[model samples]
Target: MRQVDRHPGKAEIPAGELWLVVDSGVKKWACLSCPGGCGVQISLSLNPEHRPRWKVEQDFWRRPTISPSIHQQKMCRCHFWIRKGQIEWCKI
Candidate 1:
């Protein structure tokens, strides 16, 4: 995952790279393309006040691990976990 001052454009984020939107030194959003190969854009909230907020942690290698699995309820309906910058798809 990479930190960006603002939200990145759709094409700006390369495969397997997540953009962590940090404005004023505060993490605000986590954006990435759907790992389900559905060509969907996923933006998860990092705000504590918001429902379904996700927390991000980084290892010494700068690999990111997000708490709670990402579950897409729309088109793809893909469910997965990101641990150590790797995608672990749920068996459903």
Candidate 2:
């Protein structure tokens, strides 16, 4: 799992995976790779509300077509971005 700068407490929950966290309602809840361009969705369940806290639809990946960064050079499809921690899917 990797922690993103924007969301210091939140980490990439991994593709096709789900994670649950209990928040104190002071901080924001979000899915790491969703809005950034990854074709993944994240749903959160909060105590007063049972709605999706963050959701990234698969179609989001088709539009805007964000390119990989220089750090991802020569990496395979399975490789992806993780700002805070190492990626289990990709190892150098």
Candidate 3:
């Protein structure tokens, strides 16, 4: 996981399948690569003004957890949540 001001900035968006990119602190955006290995990047908005946004919480383990689930309407059709630094996929 990497904290960046801009996507693909100094960071390469780690090649790890489950890599995360946090932009402008934890409130700007939380991005991740699609688990489908389709080389697509997913961006979750944290801006309150945005119609659909996600919230990130920290567990006792300091692991990042995302709520309300992530559903991709396009392409791979992946749906899941990140809890305790793990991806818990929901039935698509």
Give the per-residue lDDT digits (tens) of candidate 1, residues 1-92: 78889877665466788999999999999998888877788889999999989999999999999878999877789999999999999899
Give per-residue CA lDDT, model 2, range 43-73, as digits (tens): 3322335343332212333321111211222
Per-candidate TM equals 0.91, 0.24, 0.75
| Higher-scoring candidate on lDDT, 1 or 2 | 1
Cα displacement (Å) at residue 20, model 2? 0.9
Give the per-residue lDDT digits (tens) of candidate 3, residues 1-92: 45566555334344433334455454577777776556567778777788698887777876878887988767888888788888888974
Instruction: Give candidate 2's total backbone clashes.
Output: 0
Give the Cα-based TM-score of candidate 2 against the true structure.
Answer: 0.24
* C-alpha lDDT of candidate 2 relative to the true structure: 0.33
Compare the candidates by lDDT and give the number of the best one. Answer: 1
lDDT of 2 at 4: 29
Which has the greatest TM-score? Answer: 1
- For model 2, name the residue pairs that clash: none
Relative to the unseen true structure, what is the C-alpha lDDT of residue 80 in candidate 1, on a scale of 0 to 100?
96
